[model samples]
Target chain A: MSRTRVQHFSISLDGFGTGEGLSRQAPFGHAGERLHAWMFATRFGKTMFGQQGGTSGVDDAILSTFAVGIGAEIMGSNKFGYPGWHENKDWTGWWGANPPFHTPVFVMTQHKRAPLELEGGTVFHFTDAPPADVLAMAREAAGGRDVRIGGGVRILRAFLKERLIDHMHLVQVPILLGRGVRLWDGLEGLEQVFDIETTASSSGVTHLMFARKGG
Target chain B: MSRTRVQHFSISLDGFGTGEGLSRQAPFGHAGERLHAWMFATRFGKTMFGQQGGTSGVDDAILSTFAVGIGAEIMGSNKFGYPGWHENKDWTGWWGANPPFHTPVFVMTQHKRAPLELEGGTVFHFTDAPPADVLAMAREAAGGRDVRIGGGVRILRAFLKERLIDHMHLVQVPILLGRGVRLWDGLEGLEQVFDIETTASSSGVTHLMFARKGG
Candidate 1:
């Protein structure tokens, strides 16, 4: 059984997973854009945008870990698009022309959309299938590499609830929305254990890596 | 024009700005619960639960800032008690006999719910009127002291969208829900200029005070 890893997910100072001051147009809100400013300012970020001459720092190192060279990525509907979870097959990935998930990306959605082909092998497979199934396909697509669970929050919950997550790398940034959406609710006590593997960063953003104590 | 402070909000890495996870229930989502934990772990927190002998730290200090010798506080209808945007008037404060806001706390709502006097000076008012109207009520209630806008999201959005918030304080904690609801979504062109005032902590949590550059 292959394991799933959640990497580089950042949060506002207020504990929101995402979507604090969000709308259909902005989606991530003002603060959320700030949460990831550090990510896109690095060498790895430049590579994603087809730019050159970027610096390598804590941000670069972290973003580089999420590259196609490292793992396969998975996401939920919310991360893929907007609200109105009703059937809308026309919804495309947020990134215009070329999305960052150039590798095979698995999206979790009840409404199925055709596999979207873009620059690189970024074939977005939308499935109404269960998280386990999506993850399984993602693992296969990853080809023995680690699978990164990209999120909008719901997808992360599904895996966490089932204890399917192996390593979680959280990049907590400094900024609070106070209210919007949150990362921790309901799933409190269920024998979920994670051991801190590392807490490293150069920017104000702190990266925390936690894995099963023994696994 | 009296300035309104939108305190303690959350956000995610992608800027989705919402926490509403389907399986996730009540008051945002996973991140919503994280936002509450800081207050819940404070001495003022114990005071709210009719207990005592709680520890003090940045979290406690922030809580004390609101609990002891405070000015006034405000909460949206969702945080006050009522779930989502229901026109019903049965809901009151989330706290049972006593709520954390010991001073006068204003409630933002559309439907009118008869103000029920709690054990403390905490008062819940229904202002379906407008954001500015509620702000006026809150300022008047504060007399000459500062007013804290305790929020869920929408209420914060009203002020944030209107650019009415002055000082914004966010407590960044480490935890992930993966998905429930979000905080900083849909807020575009917020044009907020902030000054990082103070920083300190307890319980691995950091307390950051951002005074809107002008205010």
Candidate 2:
């Protein structure tokens, strides 16, 4: 069975999961961008982004997991990298024309925007549905694969509140934005146990995979 | 004579920032929020956030610098942490009624919003202003008091590109989101020199600082 899993999420040492203000120009801001620098230069990203001469090695081995086992993806509107509801809504998002996730994507948004259709088998579904509704949707879309509880912050916490997560994968980079949009803002209670797997990248990013207790 | 100096910022050996999905619930998420766990409980942050009864000592000293000598502040719209532009033109940002910064705040944005007046001596100015313009604003506002270039990656990079930043404070946390956003996207061509200052918090986050060359 596919329990809930939060795959490949990074956190900052300042106890902030993400740097504040993820905007178009600086999605990750200051040290925020350094978190994923390793992945971009990796063979996986280069190949996906259609760049030539990408390096291959252990890093590539790690990069391989980025797309391997996974069913559907979930994220907040900001996580989708799109801001605001426009009249036309023609913006295909910041990923140029094609985005990496080519499957059904569940986007969390409060407003009412039509679902987005993309070239590479990607469809954006906007929902004001509850976390449970979204998760249920993701699981069905997964088709017995796995669910990626992708996100901004609030979306992820929605699932974590009920312990609906199964696995978490993150790449922690060596940088810090003292304070901005910190990962931990309102979580003062609730406890968790994480089985962690870690590795340091050549560019100095640390990759980790976490699994919740007992499936 | 500005030397490259890194300060106050912290990170982890594994590079996971506090945690992914910085929302009100899990806050730092799992081991993620643990990034800044050491600071909020310290003296400086307590004072800044206006709380009482925090532990003081080594951690307080460290926390102080994150706020100390901060003559001015720089941030992008994202760093502002307001819900969305749809809210209203007069948004004062996430810092409570009275914000932490008592100086001029330079906000970089595409849309020009009206300047926000805050409870304390804080005024928010929006400009499609280039990084140079923003820095000029910050420096002018700084009045020789040494400005703190605060932000997510894009704002920082824009400043870095112009070589206008004087000192950078970073905290490296050990939490990784394999893919979400990376900090160095536009870092390819920017020129920067690193002078490192290392400090460790109880939560295992590493603090770093940088002062650019030739301020």
Per-residue CA lDDT of candidate 1, range B1-215, in tens?
Answer: 34566555543333323355422145554445554666677787787677876778757766665533346777776666635535434445557776656677777766666666777677766667787777777788877666777776667767767766787666544444445444455443333456554343435444546677766
lDDT of 1: 0.65
Clashes of 2: 86
- Give residue A96's error in model 2 in angstroms: 3.6
List DockQ for all candidates: 0.06, 0.03
Docking class of 2: incorrect
Question: What DockQ class does candidate 1 belong to?
Answer: incorrect
TM-score of chain A of each: 0.86, 0.85
Q: lDDT (CA) for every model shown?
A: 0.65, 0.62
Task: Let me know the DockQ for model 2.
Answer: 0.03
**True-structure RMSD, every candidate:** 8.7, 13.7
After superposition of all CA atoms, the RMSD between model 1 and the true structure is 8.7
